[model samples]
Target: MVKSADGVIVSGVKDVDDFFEHERTFLLEYHNRVKDASAKSDRMTRSHKSAADDYNRIGSSLYALGTQDSTDICKFFLKVSELFDKTRKIEARVSADEDLKLSDLLKYYLRESQAAKVRLGCEELMMGILVCILKQCRAVWLGSQRLVDWGRRNEDLLYRRSRSLVDYENANKALDKARAKNKDVLQAETSQQLCCQKFEKISESAKQELIDFKTRRVAAFRKNLVELAELELKHAKTGFLCVAPAILELTQ
Candidate 1:
């Protein structure tokens, strides 16, 4: 056993083995979580693309509608001019120049006023529709952007988790190698019992060195695990505090 920086005794074999097993379990769970997060990220990316496509389509439609409205307005204005010219011709034929009849003037004014009102109403209705569509497009754009940001944050977390797993695996392999060496030393010492008494002191010193080395290894591995845990916690906090708020802002 070896003492850790925190003054806690760390076992060389049993405790280390148990710790590694726990880490393996955690790594498995973490890997699954990463996979899930990746799938979600992919979905979010696809959604963003779809939203962008929709925005483009809607923008094109709005442009076409605006152009059509302008063309229709121009046509209506020309038709109104034609009506006025016809009215003048009729007035000339009816009275040659006697101050245009009050009835004729009233008729012309009423027709012009009605046509203007209809054109204004149509334009207003179209504008309202365009405004509604634009608002919807803005909301969709915001949602897609939020998803992309969230997904990127998740991917960063996943990368950290993966690195931690790799560290754990490397630590486990080192421990395994140390254990094998210790086993070889034990077997050789046992087989050389003919001179055991003469070499008793040396054997004891060797045993102590082996124990110290194993203890140090265990303590170092435990420290690594602790650091990994802290890093994971930091990532979790960042996601909640930073990414979550950004997502909320987008929603708003």
Candidate 2:
């Protein structure tokens, strides 16, 4: 039995026990991948935050430098240009780190796709087992119905004894037996119906879980993309600052 988010217990069918085990294994692997991705995301977030803070600090320092006299401004500009060059190299390293991260993210996405395929295969196997079981149950029910019909039709022959009292007794006994058999068949059919209902509910829950997993993966991807874009913008701004003094000198 597996417990769902709602605390409902989903009983696994014996026929699909192997499939369920395979699914459990896959889930374990998927969980590990999620943990790795989460760790990487956290590192990336911290790195980006540190880089942003450093850029802000440098910008504040540059603003203060701008308040000095012309000679001091020239000396500051020279130093600022050297600092900007160093910053440009740092930006390159950051870009490289982002590229590596993107690569890892893509690999993780591929793994997710493979995992989804495995999950789909498992579902298909479970569905096949369900269909086979339903078919077998239906066959049994149909066969039981035919037996009941045959017994009813042969009631007279079954009681074809010489004495009237004996014949009446035999007919009553046969009727009782037929009624018991019908009751058994009805109970079996009811059990099968219940089992089918449970199976369907479990299948739906699995589908919903898959959807939720994909939603989370997509959200993470979007977040990473946004961060990468922001990093690129920051790099471009730094480049502009590095070239601004040269532009101003040429203009003069």
lDDT of 1 by residue, 57-152 (tens): 554554444456557655444444433333333333322111122222222223322322222112111111001112224654454344334333
| Alpha-carbon RMSD of each model | 32.3, 20.6
TM-scores of the models, in the given order?
0.26, 0.40
Candidate 2 lDDT, tens digit per residue, 163-192? Answer: 222223344455566567765555555555
**Full-model lDDT for every candidate:** 0.37, 0.48
Model 1: colliding residue pairs: none
Global local distance difference test of model 2: 0.48
